[model samples]
Target: MNYKDPSLPTAARVDDLVARMTLREKAGLLFHTIWFAPPPGAETAESMIDGRHMNHFNVLGGGSPREMAEWHNALQERAAATRLGIPVTFSTDPRHSFSSNPGASMMAGAFSQWPEPPGLAAIGSAELVRKFADIARREYVAVGIRVALHPQIDLVTEPRWSRANGTFGQDAELTSRLVRAYILGFQGERLGPGGVACMTKHFPGGGPQKDGEDPHFAHGREQVYPGGRFEHHLKPFEAAFDAGTSQIMPYYGMPVGTEHEEVGFGFNKGVITGLLRERYSFDGIVCTDWGLITDAFIMGQEMPARAWGVEHLTPAERMLKAIEAGVDQFGGEACPDLLVELVEDGRISTARLDESVRRVLREKFTLGLFDAPFVDPDAAEEVVGRADFARAGFEAQTASLTLLKNGPLPLADGARVYVEGVDADVAAGYGKVVATPEEADVAVVRLAAPYEHRPGAFEAFFHSGSLAFPAAEIDRITRLQATVPTVVDVYLERPAVFPEIAEGAVAVVADYGASDRALLDVLFGRAEPQGRLPYELPRSMAAVEASPSDVPGGTADPLYPFGHGLTS
Candidate 1:
């Protein structure tokens, strides 16, 4: 077939292949579902690929590098045996970070660990962003993950929003400055064979949620823009589009009171078709956010699909609406049967299905998956989490630590230290690990950015709602500060309210994601804390609540403003 010829142009090959694909095969191309990290040679996925004709998968869990490579090889081998022999394209959320919010990113179990995106935002260096993307690209290719569901270009204007930690923070100009570098590093000047394709996400801005609530759940549906900075938020995404991002994932939030319809971005025709497709001229793959058509069972709890304004519609209607809204594929879903039904019943046209299929197949061809899909397990083992990469990651972790208040930092050696929320052995390298504050000369306490505990295990993965530390917890922390000259390091997953801790602690540090060693390196005189706050740390929840969700840095009295940091 002409489609099998590598010498042929991609468009010609895509056209030829689309003509030959069965309705089932064509329907399968419209759905990109989660693999949920099955065993290396799991027959379940193989059976589905052959039976349902599905090929796209999201790598949802972690394993050894060799094991992941072996799994990729096995999956490819199955594809080779199929009638058309289309290679499976594997995608993953950010896995090179310390924070393991399944909703946003996963843990770097064996992957080289770097700081979170907010940490990258704090550094605010385009070159550094490029370097990190390059390193991440190399690691991803080693394990056969061809697509990255990240470079989450969503602005961090809404400080209390759960997903801000994964995004470039708060400034349109800074994020725009960094996004071109990010895309260039990941996919080079152009996406081709051996390059990891970036899916820059939550299109047309997902920030500015009502009451700082994430739209992943039903209660958090409305995405308001009272500040009318809608055009301001599009700057980063416009940059991403220009840099040749391969795919786009619109967020679940429905734009309320805007020129666009009240439905979610995934279901809103005006936003997806009119804005992203027409205004921005982004012709890349437009996939919906996870579970837009069906419910999910994540971390052993039943979760509803984020249908937003279209919750009243059935799953099939929702699927049809998303397809009509200019979506090329359904993310985190597997029901191509409904699509097949839609087409057979004449609700969806063959031309429409082929249009999306062409886009999906073109990426597969451009990635050279059809020609060479297999990977070497040995190379995977050697390249992943290697010495230089690990060292670079550690350096980034150290570089991104923000010293909010430098009081009594750069502590002397052999000082008696009372440690809380840090490993004793790790802290011992810098000072004597004392059992109690009374026995110690100084105290080191590590705390996570406060988040409201919602019901269900899956819901808890998203640290949304109140940024304020609980009253009792604040009291306990104050009591600890009274014991000794306490050095407090709080992990700022998102912008938080911690004025009391800022005032009470002798020294206060903010880290996006760091190890005990990295913290100790900065706490001691070994490494300089060169990071700054990505967004303002508001003085109180009242300040957080009173401030506009769409606007950045207008709190009543911020405890620490953006770019606030100090050196020891």
Candidate 2:
């Protein structure tokens, strides 16, 4: 009855809910899984709201704000029909960024799109990062998304790491400052019921991956610290802790040669219980990175469980170990039956299950989900991706462009231009669009940070491996540059190597995630590239290989060092 009362304190409400929940219901609170959006025809029990009693979810795909809100209301209506009526907590990865890697961040659909975190880092303003978070939070809340699986504050110490675009940058102090601002913008001075809760991720930092290989794959499981700067990576999480971030998700990478066990951070008791819980005093809910307990087929590929050191254990055993390791919930896992089995067999105590359930219920109650569980579908359309938010995003895209090389000043007004990899119609707004570089006074080309091609549908999205531009690609760019004074804008998703292109191009600029209009505005001097290099651009793959994974600013004589920028 107290849980049903809106006037009661969150703790009291949580206590009431915990006392009444059955063992199966308590077990259900420990698993959070990928939520399937509504099918074209009839909907089924994919969410386990009735069959498994699971309530927490991570929404994968994008949708219009109105449709998302309507789906949420329908989903919450199902929860209301349940015995206990515990409202669902919908969470999502970064949807405001340009990165479309489904494994990392979702690309925007109807949501306002902005530059990636590194672009915010390029601008290097805590205030702007906070503003971005605030706008993103409002957009998320409007569509009934209560949890943010982001503000991924991992320090980008490893330049070749595929996940660099999701992080702030390599500098620990700078990242720490931004992390604090980001959490504040999302959760605010208090974890206000009106605000969205942040799940700051890849705890203790996920950036120092061995050989720059992502831990998402089996072959790339080691998180090495050859530079002996393991403590350096924890600075941002410490800042997150200080900022009162509501949740934590440990990374999937296993520690290679650290004092702790050589297991993934999600399954490491030393890291989670001893380090995060005891030393740092982080009492927030700790969820494991996705798919750590079970293996399944995803994106037409055989996805293996990221059990790391405990791959030898059965699924039930891995769940038990993670529970003992101080994890509150399993991310991207839905098998609450396994949890019930563990508790029924006396392998996991009821007290342990209740402990996690208490955290879960407290968050739901504190968020006011128990009091107001549904959203207005009509209100969502007007609030999300509104004009002001879109304008701010466009401005950020323009501001984040880092001028790495100085060439000719703003293109001669109405001068002829030849373009590649850009919208010709957008180019026509500023200058005469010519078909050939030979006929133009200047040429513009867009290049993406190069990656080794993988065949898998999902794996290919991850831009891992060597950060060098292929020789053939370089030759083509060189040939283009010789014909006219050319300007190159490379998408610096990961720090890319393109010395030949850099040498030949009249001007070189880097953008994390810029729109065509944003790039053109900067090209025409309508806006200044008010950004500096967030990470150093290596001169070649040789320098990238020579640098230690854990050390920041260690690339040997990088073509463009950190903080390198120019303005005409």
Candidate 3:
């Protein structure tokens, strides 16, 4: 139990301590929760509110810096109270930006709001990406977040996946290089002291999800590797491993009918152990995608537990299977008790527990948590949301703006321009803007497709797998185009192809997360359009419908192909 003994090498010391750990303590390391503090006066009351506890799965509702720090300290204290004093390594979803499932969104109030990964990639500077990671590391370290569950390196090949905002873009080569830089920035040269471990995710690239739906739901759980080009997905991950990523997370989808494993990657022995460990020689910890061990609840509605091709297995059975298959930890998992129960039942061997525990301990030791367990509370404000950070975000936003067209008319400086769709304040900085589309010489209509909200029925909205746009809004844009030489800017997160507007407008531009200044800069020819379309813009829902939900290949006729960008 003397983990601190210098006589033994670090790994061996970890192994020795791990060998002495009880199954419960080992399992505890595997499960992490997003720790948030209770509301102002809620702690003293006997009855608990819904969002009071440390949920472990999603955002901790919301918390102030002091509250967050206090909660993290308490959680670490609890971990220290355990037999081995294995400090709980807390993790977070991207706390920096507004993208993908904001129910899990952490406020960027304290942290810098870097442009999402697409914009960062469009900036196309490896150094900037690294710098972004470094800044994030400082902020995360301040908040006691040991693991940054991000730098999602999935190629943005599939346009329909709701989570594509997190990816770099479609080019495998670009994504590969950036992933390495990003990993280096977040993890540093070594794990210990002032560095936050990066968990590079959705291994073998999660971009090719069938029909662009996330695998979190049962209907979207199948992944197709048609043409056997599945190896293409492995490139960035290979780069990540080479760059020394501390951890990897397998995505939710399974390669159902492919040459790869039949079960979900997390539980697939061939994928996690046979390929990742044995073939690739990856020694880092493998974490399961969020909620892989239990039944999923979408918007408070409990759906039937999906085993992802392993239909006969229960949640407990799947936990044992994943651990035996080679996953070292569970991302956002709720059931550590199940892992303990499996060990007690001899379903998972003590040797396997020791193997995983040693890996986890190695990471902690590499991070130098033993030497400096607490972060400086005073440094929190100084490190987060600095002026330079906003400037970087603005620069990235500028670079990401893609100009898709030019007409007989070019934007003249001091021209009366109108903007619609986005917030009025966000649009006003563009030019002599107006409240209505008809008031100006030119109209710039910005549009983003609606996302699913919780109050809406989950099965009808998400699980059934359909995308719809409001007809009224579509009509309004079409009507405005009749009066002026309008330019349409579609933030195509889910590829809402406005055919009516596409035909009516003089020009069209598609981008991810372009700010007001960037949008106007491109409009006024202050900046050239250098960004290429990361994914093929679908012509219609029918085009998407024609393609197999499983296989996403063999399409040349898109509204706009990948790499297509028209400069003004």
Candidate 4:
């Protein structure tokens, strides 16, 4: 049991643990499947930990802070009594955002809520990014979650890309700076039992998808760089490696017309091995993006395996290709049986399996899981979502407001305010609440920019397609402006076509994602609009259509350029 001793070197401990594990035990280490943290009656902690023999899991659908903490402690206690007593490592998607795409990320429930990643970039402060990450780290560790499946370093070059809200804007240099601070905050100077190790994701960048479609579906599988700027996307990832990220996830998009193989990054040896492993010398765990070997059921709908170019291959063949491509783990998959069969059939050597097992074991030891794995449920309740943490997040929410039009902003006190898309109960404190725009002295209207609706339950969560506002909606807003001197606050998740609204309204304010209270604070002179535009707003849909997919900034004249903000 020398591996159980904390005094031993991590390498020595990893070597001992891997040497003693059975083929099934080793195979379990290579798969990280999704597990609902809330225990929805179908799956229990025993089935996931002991029956499946899984040590690593990507947790989904969490509950209140205390409820999550108690569940984590109970789960950890169960693992501690099992044979060899290996601790579980729970990973999660970004959980502090307003965007509630179940497939992409979680909503901020009981956790402190802030604007999305683009909002952080809009503020353009590396120190602030670090502080937010550190706060997130504390909240995560409080609930026994030790892995962050985030700090998505993908550049937001393509305006129509659905995942751009998760990125640090389109500038490579700025993304790099923030990426470094983010890693440092989560993992600290060195990882330990208490730290939440960051998994920097969608390696070599996921931007520049053809026509801004995601690679999660068949129609959106191809990623092309028509502007010959493929290398431009990789700058942030290079910085991520320099900052010493614990894990990496390759995107599912297959490169088209590039020097590397025309296959998904998980299945592409040139990209995964030549570029990432050999050229970059990254020795960390490389977990392939979810569902490469099997079809996945997300939110009650079955979707095809994101095998892309390797779809013609069998499930077993796809898994083998991923192993050959130098990936150490399979995400969102639980078929350790296939890996065991592949070894027995001589398709893959046991030595290859051992390579991955060693890396997996090393991470567990580096995390100090073997020495001290269980957490205090009582302590978890006290630390998560405390008053001070919520204050910082609210302040960040206020700081992220971008004032596109400053005319009549920081509105004078005691005016009758008519609000839309904001709670009337909340707005009543600032000014007299009116029933209609006509009754009000000034109208404050908030609207989320339109996106072309996609089919299916899961796809709807991801806001994709056109960034243009419909003609009918535009006409309604302009008509309202004509009737009253309106202040238009638009949630710019995808940079909406809003030139008409910008020109018609008395004032225009752009927000990535902000609560009603935060918006009111900026409007009523309680706080300043510190955020600038992280990405450009296209002048028209024609300009967006003509723009290169890989380049930063707009192709034609932008209605509002990057870093556009006004002070009162």
Summarize candidate 3's per-residue lDDT along 328-381 as a digit string, tens digits.
887656567787788899888888787777788788877766545665556655
Candidate 3 ranges with C-alpha deviation above 4 Å: 5-9, 34-67, 81-83, 100-107, 296-298, 303-306, 408-414, 426-430, 449-473, 524-529, 546-554
- How would you encode candidate 4's per-residue C-alpha lDDT over 303-377 as one tens digit per residue? 999999999999999999999999999999988888988888998898988988888888888887778776677
TM-score for each prediction?
0.98, 0.99, 0.87, 0.98
lDDT value for model 1: 0.89
lDDT assessment of candidate 4? 0.86
- Report lDDT per candidate: 0.89, 0.89, 0.68, 0.86
Candidate with the larger TM-score of 1 and 3:
1
Ranking by lDDT: 2, 1, 4, 3
The candidate maximizing lDDT is 2
Stretches > 4 Å off in candidate 2: 38-43
List model 1 lDDT by residue over 180-223, tens digit each: 89889999998998799999988888888888788888888899
